[model samples]
Target: MTLKHLIGLVRALTVFVLMVGLASAANAVEKNYTVQSPDGVTIAVQEGGNPDGRPIVFIHGLLGSRLNWEEQTSSPQLQQYRLITYDLRGHGQSGKPDEVEAYRDGRRWADDLAVVLKASDAKKPVVVGWSLGGVVLSNYLAAYGDAMIGGIVYVDGVIELNAALIAPHPEVYAGLASDDLKTHLDAVRTFIALCFQTQPDPAIFERLLSNAAMASWVMTKTVPSMTVAVADSLPKTKVPVLLLYGGKDNLVMTGPSIARAQELNPSLQSKIYPDSGHAPFLEEAPRFNQDLSDFRNSIQARK
Candidate 1:
């Protein structure tokens, strides 16, 4: 290989080493807080990184919590931003309200985020959502519109959830029913395997799956409405959107979904990790982090 090629290889290795080191040190850093929603449900949240930086709120998918984005919250990328990851109403450490109304649409989720942002005194943050977290961020934009956020990053998020349009299946329900966290982790691994089309770090898969098992039971019950409501409102949103997908993602990261998302918001910027699947953030952390940083920088440049 030429010297130029060698230099590029060295840079890549340096980034990889830096990321691995950050991952190793991440587990020990943790903080917990709670935010009360409009309806009185107290949402659970976890935070890390530079508290003085620009606020970047993270929302996890169905059966996920702030822990889902643990690595991202811990990484050096966060040095430029204050990271906020939260458990939606019935998931993770958040209050699990029994009524479906409590979880319906993305309004309450957005409200919970607003409460958290207000508490943090982080104005107009860049909201990042994974899975249903994407829907929540979009709905936040829909309700409060662009006035509430600087930008949005959707990490293998549900661009829209209409089964009739996207084809839902029993695996979705089966995934939610996994009582053993290990089994849930396995299922997510299987799911990720199908989506990533490439090998992923087995340990990250395990950690996320464990979080899924702990936070997911309630998602099965509420997903139907979350899908319908978010779909109905997506097309009207005009805020800047960044969409990232795992090429191997079997759930919602398909071509049609990407196309539909773009159609809904013509300005939506998208990136695909050909080797990744549903959980791109974990499955391909380094690439995902770089892409996210680039997207954020691009937005900053525009401003």
Candidate 2:
């Protein structure tokens, strides 16, 4: 090669190397934080990635922690987004405060989220909630619906949690009403098996058990109230919503539930992973990440 061409090549390679180095440096510094709720529950959170990128917050279900969304937080598609995930007040690394009243409604839970966002100085974030996490998100939007939030992604969750709870179907109702964690889990597994058309995984069951055993009195209060509230007001969430469900979800009756949810809010957009059940993020991480990325891009593009 001519000396001129070689010099040009060196400069181009140097620029590429610098860009990669900057990205690597940015990826290395994932920060973790803790925020105290109004009721004194210290919730754990982790924040990192492009500080100027769109903020995306993930909320887990009844018996889960921020750890459940670890894949989303670390995803390359999410690298350009400021990702945040946290444990509910009584679950995961968060403080388990006793008393059902503390968890009765999603108001305090919303406050907890607001505090965390403010503490981190994050912009209006697009919140992705799963199962009970979706309940909390709906409640947050219902009570504090505003432009502060860019969008909502209900991952196997909905605006009317209580409606799902009260839906007629002796078998499903019987399954949801069980107070025994073991029995509830069996029902969950059975439901999963039915929906997925396959045997349920023992590892998933064990994780559910671990999450259940840690539940506080507060977590229990969240169930009935959240159920009723959503039943009463499922159609009001007008924010951009994406309902992603697992066709194999055992606890949630997919067809009827999604149909009813869409009926309540005509603006609701949805997608279902046929081969997966309740935990799509865990069961199909790559596809889940891609779908989420595409959704986020669409949201960003609109603005």
Candidate 3:
């Protein structure tokens, strides 16, 4: 009832409220939604982390969905930032168009990304594209330019599908495109295995396998022949670009990929994980998260 006692209680209550708010933000569950791409295909999008914090949009590779970014979405180091992820058109919970034409143009993939950004109302977020997701980034740049985005991180990205950059995997590609369920499933397993120098955790691999299985067969058959605009688009990107490659990658030739990318955009910055294979983000997640945070911080500092 005394003045000093009432002041002390108020101070304690304020501290308690602040702590609760922080906890809630840290524990916020990822929110999922579906946004229609320009062509009317529904793309499944997920958002988490501090809603008010700087945003980072994660684009997964072929046969992957938002689920591929679990290493990033659940990262404690990145909790201070907004995390956004989505499934590519024919993958995961997104609508899968049976028409081969739907997956042929690279620009449609780019437009899908734009749709996700518009739907989320993200303000110039940094985009991280992995593996096949790199194709999406190039198309996006060709279509939208860099004015709408702050920066980008290319994680073990596929710069060009040319022989010099893409490792020889005729057997795998052939099997994947096959209509035989047994052969297709076997190829999927082989392809995922080739993603890492060391094997992934059994549980994680299983989860990824399940996601890959859910992908549309039509996409697998059509996307290989899709046009890549990296040569045209990458040369024109004005935003900060970071390239992360795994030296031991079997799916993509790391050295050649980086060289081709840098040749296209001389402003690109890069890092290599000698021990990792195709998926450095998962093989070295702790390091990847810190590096990403640092990249975001550097961009913020410049602004």
Candidate 4:
């Protein structure tokens, strides 16, 4: 072939390769959808990663939305798994019913999760819950059982919230109940600070403060009563459980909680991030992601 013709062919091949790469990148982009709960509340859902891969649903804590899982969703380690996140009712973009009864009923939380799972078409998926989300997950298992879930991961979550268990964190309840906006915000800020062993990024701290400020007061007041004895459910759970906690977590007493969980379910596996606090997933993303990936792989192997 002539030299000019060879050069032209090479250019064409490069253009074709570039176009394909761009197309693949576009295809990998995450997709968002709106899922409606049985009670008519709308949940904003985001799905990404391998479409046909094992589903992993992440439920964020009180005053937290699907955005809380940005690190996990964007991590290359989880790109091979189907990742799902959604705003819990009364948080984020989801509808907030003004009635106290809405947030007080534990069934509502479970039902909302059921709808999200059904909408996502997640079959026997691995469910990960953080903080209040842990309570929600327990409520779900109580109401729906483990038929639809293959595994559970609790990240600095509450297993029980009886007066004794909650007594140590008066600041948390005080922050939630404060009538003065400044008092409430300040308390919330303190609570956030307590969640980390080290100071968080300024932007992240600001964002968390903003999100906490948006939480409905009624929901805050009602959540304490909504919790059931999740430890009771452990005896019946046959699925693998990974309890991830922050050793420095002043919010949730990790030792007692983990001890109680292991006592109830001997098969339960756990790991503590000694350098981290309440939100270990955020405080130690690399290690947390690796643990999550390992947990996911173990579950997949059993399946």
Better of 1 and 4 by lDDT: 4
Which predicted model would earn the best TM-score?
3
Q: What is residue 168's positional error in candidate 3, in angstroms?
A: 0.7
The Cα local distance difference test for each model comes to 0.70, 0.71, 0.91, 0.84
**Candidate 4 lDDT for residue 111:** 88
Q: Clashes in model 1: which pairs?
A: 63-216, 195-248, 195-249, 196-248, 196-276
- Clashing residue pair totals per candidate (backbone < 3 A): 5, 2, 0, 0
- Mind giving the per-residue lDDT tens digits that candidate 1 earns over 1-303? 999999999999999999977864563356687878888988887766666656677888766667777668767765566677778877777887767777765677778877887776766677788877877776776666576677788887776666633435467457545676665555565654453455546786566566655653555566666633454446665656788887767667457777877877677888888877677888777777787777666666777
User: Candidate 2: lDDT over CA atoms?
Assistant: 0.71
TM-score of each: 0.78, 0.78, 0.93, 0.91
TM-score of candidate 4 against the unseen true structure:
0.91
Q: Taking the tens digit of each residue's C-alpha lDDT, what string does model 4 give over 1-303?
A: 999999999999999999988865564578898887788878788888777778899999987788788889888788878888988888888888888888888878898999999988997888999988888888898888899898999998888775544427786678778788887777788877887888779998888877777778778778887857475577889999999999988788888888877887889999999989889889999999999988988988987
Report residue 46 deviation for candidate 3 (angstroms).
0.4
Off by over 4 Å in 3: 1-22, 25-27
Worst 10 residues of 2 by lDDT: 191-200
In model 1, where do residues sit more than 4 Å from their true spots?
1-31, 164-168, 171-203, 216-218, 227-236
TM-score of model 2 relative to the true fold? 0.78
Name model 4 segments beyond 4 Å from true. 1-20, 163-167, 229-232
